[model samples]
Target: MDRNLGMDFVRATEAAALSSGRWVGKGDRHAVDQAACEAMRRTLGDIDMKGVVVIGEGERDEAPMLYIGEELGTGNGYAVQIAVDPVEGTNLVATGQPGAISVVAAAIEGEGKLLRAPDIYMDKLVVGPAAKGAVDITLPPRMNLKVIAKSLGKEVQDLTVGMLDRPRHEQLIREIRQAGARIRLVSDGDLSLALEALDPQGEIDVLMGIGGAPEGVLSAAAALCMGGEIQARLVFRNEQERERAKQLLGTEDVDRVLTMEDLAWGNVVFAATGITGGNLLGGVRYTGWGAITHSVVMRSRSGTIRWLETHHHFHHDPRY
Candidate 1:
């Protein structure tokens, strides 16, 4: 894939963020998601690549666009596998809460590049580059926090773990609190929190919990780009998901610890733009001149991470 493809993906995410930004406080998650997906899909038509949707919004039956198996992008260029989350935190955006983002991650199309997982929950444990080899998701959260704290030269009490605030994580939260580590809970967007774990000198030290398997793949791509680490295992909620995993993995054994590479490997590019203000990237802000959007673009092949603040003049930018 061309090294410049990362910037093109950023433009797509930026378009999604801008389109969805207008619907904030509309109290309509479907509207938020649809606006983002349509904007991203339209913007992608201008990119110079032929992409197959290995992971995306949902299955063809569930979403109108950017769904699984949907072909993406345009122009005479490279073939790639794309996984996108146009509105990562749909509830946040619809409710006018903070920390919503539009994300896109792609790998060179091949068997070993991106895992083709169903829309199931995935248990994830992510850490920064410094503690990549230190923590293990199979171990207890307390123990992993200890190893992470040691790797960072800090005490367990000084470390902060971030995760989604869900009923399933009640015990996980209790255990982390028992270990004397701080916890920051969010309503949505664990993918952003996973990247926050890699933010240099960022507030969050680690991200742990179950989230969308596809989102895990996207986060893993960014983690690989920035030298961070994310490990995941699919968590089947029912027999249907279990059967789906079997069909995808070619076996009945659905439980296996997946490394970062197993999630998203080989020359990968990741791009995200915040729709609402958050830690990783600032939300879209309207100015008298135009609108300013904050975005992060990364490519694993070149080991590059670029944070961009783009100014879009609605008059000139037809997409807006």
Candidate 2:
């Protein structure tokens, strides 16, 4: 992949964020997602790449669906696998909550790198570089927190874990609290939570619990680029999903733990532009010029993470 491809990818995210930012706090969830996906798909079609979207994990009932095998880009440049959550937190955007984002991740297509996971639940444990390889997902939550705390040279009480506010995390939350670490539970957008967990100066020290499998793959790409670690395993809701997983993943056992490489490998490019104010980046702020957007772009091969603040001029660009 070209080194400058990350910049092109960020443009798509910015477009999504800019379009969707208008719908924030509008109480229209579907419209929020539809606007973002349309803008993103349009922007991606102009990029110089032959890209296939590997994962479209947004909840179909809540937001507009982007087909899993949809072909993107101009189809004339790098062959890549694309994964997107054009609006990671539709409800947040609708309700005027925080942490809504537009995310895009890509890797070389047909390279057997980025995992095309079945749309199911995935249990994940993610941490930053300091605690990389020091925590294990299979271990007890308290035990893992202890190890992570030790690695970061902090007490357990000083560490903060991020998770989705779901019933399935009840036991996990108990264990984390028992271990003396604090918790920050959000309504949605696990990808943003995972990214903040990887940030050295970010408030989230770890991210633990179950989230959508497609989001897990998206998070895995950011992990590869940001020197973070994620350990995950597929969680089947029923026997039918298990059979479908067998068909989709072939003989690869879903019961096995998936390292970051197994989820998303190669020189993956990950980009996210924030739509609402949150932990990872600031929300899109409109101005007389057009809008000001904040985005982060990263690449695994170069280990370069760029935080870009773009001022879109409506008169000059007219894409808005």
Candidate 3:
């Protein structure tokens, strides 16, 4: 469906400003997330839209804002399904790191399904189309890396991979080191990390790590639109979380690898407005006198991704 793509930037910027800061460590992630939610809610109020939360902060009653099944938009246009991460890297923002962003994607409602992601960790691997079927998450990380290396006609050491900069990634990191492969460790945010994996020419060959299941789902949605292969499996740490997941998914099978089509099915449109400077999208630019927002509006139906950097000027209200 054709909707107002340009105005989506207004909402994106609002989400970004609410939670801009160094919010790393055990600091209140809720505040940053809340900022994005509030902005999203308010921004939705201004548009004639009907959308469902496919991927959100949490389920109903669990997360006060942006819960699954929560209705958004002004309720006047075609219904759409929205998956949002107001601040993809709360820790990065809190710690003043690069690549922090307020990310969101939307698809036609009913055609899209929100993933009842398990609270437990999910192992994720992504590669471009050329390397499709070359890597498998079922194998050990080293073996998978080797396959990817062979597919790209490069040594494992020449392949640059993206990883999270956390102690939990110690073994994964060590294995890569032992293999003589280089690793690009990110302090926070995996949304861009996942995107990086899709662009081999961009220097990031693959993305292998354990991250939030919801994020894994969102990345799958984006990759679905971008033509990449991603495999994910739930890795629960406790029975309670597993049971909760099973109950939500309405199935006992937690070990499933979701493809791009599985993440975002049918027709969808993705709108992203940059709140901070980074690759894939540019940061919000201020001209001192006013502000100009840069954005990329995409439609899956047409496979057209347009780069738009628009300027919005604000001056004092004119009162007669």
Best by lDDT: 2
Q: Candidate 1 at 65: error in angstroms?
A: 4.4
Candidate 1 pairs with clashing backbones: none
Q: Please, what are the lDDT tens digits per residue for candidate 1 over residues 153-215?
A: 999999999999999999999999999999999999999899899876678999999988888
Q: Looking at model 3, report the run of 10 residues with the lowest lDDT sum.
A: 17-26
- The list of candidate 1 runs beyond 4 A from truth reads 60-65, 110-112, 318-320
Model 2 global lDDT (CA atoms, 0 to 1): 0.88
Per-residue CA lDDT of candidate 3, range 219-308, in tens?
776566566678877878788778887887788776676666555666666555555566665655567675655555555566666666
Query: Considering only N, C-alpha and C atoms within 3 Å, which residue pairs clash in candidate 3?
Result: 21-93, 22-93, 22-94, 22-95, 23-94
In order, what lDDT does every prediction score? 0.87, 0.88, 0.67
- Clash count (model 1, backbone only): 0
Which numbered prediction scores highest in TM-score against the true structure?
Answer: 2
lDDT-based ranking: 2, 1, 3
Per-prediction TM-score to the true structure, in the order listed: 0.96, 0.96, 0.85
**Candidate achieving higher lDDT, 1 or 2:** 2
* RMSD (Å) of each candidate, 1 decimal: 1.7, 1.6, 4.0
Candidate 1 accuracy as TM-score = 0.96
Q: Which clashing pairs does model 2 show?
A: none
